[model samples]
Target: MHAGRRFTLTEILVWTRREILVLFGLSLVPTVLYAGLGWHWLGMPWVPIALVGTATAFVVGFKNNATYSRLWEARQVWGSIVNTSRSWAVFVRDWVGSAPPTGPGFLDARQQLIYRHVAWLTALRFQLRESRAWEHMHEPANVEYARNYRIAERETILAEELAPYLTPAEAAYVLGKKNRATHLLALQSQQLKELLDHDHLNNLLHLQLVPLLVNLYEQLGRCERLKNFPYPRQFATLNLLFVRLFAGLVPFGLLPEFEKLGAHFVWLTIPFSMLVAWIFLAMEKAGETAENPFEGGPNDVPITALSRNIEIDLRELLDELTIPAALQAENNILL
Candidate 1:
């Protein structure tokens, strides 16, 4: 997500410059038709257009609120992941130990659980980053904005990433599965079961740890629900339609009103109309950008960085000196 205090005006304008140019064209056309071409009859009264604007404002507001809710919920899911992951690390580190001294495999079991949990995070983030048909990542404006930073999932292969955290056989098994994250959790449960069977983990601690696993699954399901489902298309379509309709009608509504003030005042319609149209377009674009929080948008949850942070915390808990560094935001964008 944008880690800066707020987006600079220059950045905002640059992001919307193309649309601003289009708005200028939309505004200039009617002003030219009415003022230059003397097409006095082309101008419409402002009252009906203002009425459309009022309705469009409500729709746009509703869309923004809904989209923001989706974004906030996605962030909250990852927040649960952060908490669950730390708890999992704690349980794995403290709970799994030889009750009556075992072999070389005993300590390795604890390490494996922590590493595999990290692998699960990596896989889930990769899955979430997968492009959806409804996502705005492919849109020109989003694509352009994305160039300022890197998406870690896009830069690396899942297999290569998972390799460090899982054994060859397990990684192969996980890669073979359609839902790698779910299968990884299964593997975690299976390992915990084996630990309990081998007398490495107590029945009491095992029970508690299992609930944490359940929590992880619940959080995963929440993330998947957000990733798989999109805001209703009907509302999205109608919101855009209304915004565009109002933007197009803006100059027509303003030109005649300005002409009444003075001959020169009609020229004011071009700038005023463009300003009004740009505001509506910006609002619509903001909602659209927030619609898919996992699509690697600048305003997204920064799951890649969050996953890395979890890995760092878990590895440090393991007392590993060679742990990877935490990801820093590039260009003030963490993902």
Candidate 2:
């Protein structure tokens, strides 16, 4: 996500430059026709158009509110994952050896459990980063802006990334599965079972740990739901249609209103109308970009950076010396 206080005017203009140009043309065309060609008949009553503008504003507001809800929900799910991950680390470290005569596999089991959880995080973010047909990342403006920062999932290989955390056999098994994150959690359950059988973990601790796995499953499923089910397409389509419709009316609406000031003031339609259209258009664009929170856009949840942080925190809990540094944002974007 954008790490700065707010986007610079330059960045906002750069992102919407193409649309602004279109708005300018839309405004300038009618102004030239009415002012130069004496087509004063093109001017329409402003009251009806003002009603359209008000309706468009309500629609845009609804869209922005819905999209922001999706983003906030995604962030909440990730926050849960962060807490669950730390709890998992603590459980594996402290509770796995409750029985006397902790087996030779004690440390190995702890490391395996924690590292595999990290692997699960890696797999999940990669899955979430996968492109969807409805996402705006495929649009030219979003595609161009993405070059300003890196998407770690796009740059790295998932299997190669999962390699460090899983044993050869476990990695192969998980890679073979269709839902890698779900299977990884299943493996965690199975490992807990094996630990219980060997007395490395007692019944009480195993029962507690199993619920943690379930919580992870719930969080993972939450993220998947947001990823798979897009915001209602009908609402999106209508929102865009209404915004464009009002934008088209803006210049004609302003024409007679400006002409009241003076004949020369009719030329004011170009800039004034363009300004109004751009405001609505920019608001629509902002909602569109934020609607999909996991589509690898700059405005998306910084899952890669969040996953790296969870790893660092979990590893340090294990007293490991080789933990990687937390990820920093590039060009004021964290994803």
Backbone clashes, each candidate:
0, 0
State TM-scores per candidate: 0.97, 0.97
User: What lDDT would candidate 1 get against the real structure?
Assistant: 0.91
Q: After superposition, how far is residue 83 of candidate 1 from its true place, in Å?
A: 0.6
TM-score of 1: 0.97
Q: Write the per-residue lDDT of candidate 2 for residues 197-303, one digit (tens) a residue.
A: 98898999998999999999999999999999999999999999999999999999899999999999999999999899999999999999889999999899999
Q: Which stretches of candidate 2 lie over 4 Å from their true place?
A: 98-107
Q: What does candidate 1's lDDT look like per residue over 1-335, in tens digits? A: 99989889988999999989989999888788888989999899999999999999999999999999999999999999999999999988888883432223324888888888999999999999999999988888778889999998999999999988888888889999999999999999988888899888889999999999999999999999999999999999999999999999999999889999998999999999999988999999999989999999999999989999999999999998898888998899997
By summed lDDT, the worst window of 10 consecutive residues in model 1 runs over 98-107
Q: Candidate 1, after superposition: displacement of residue 231 in Å?
A: 0.9
In candidate 1, which residue pairs get closer than 3 Å at backbone N, Cα or C atoms, i.e. clash? none
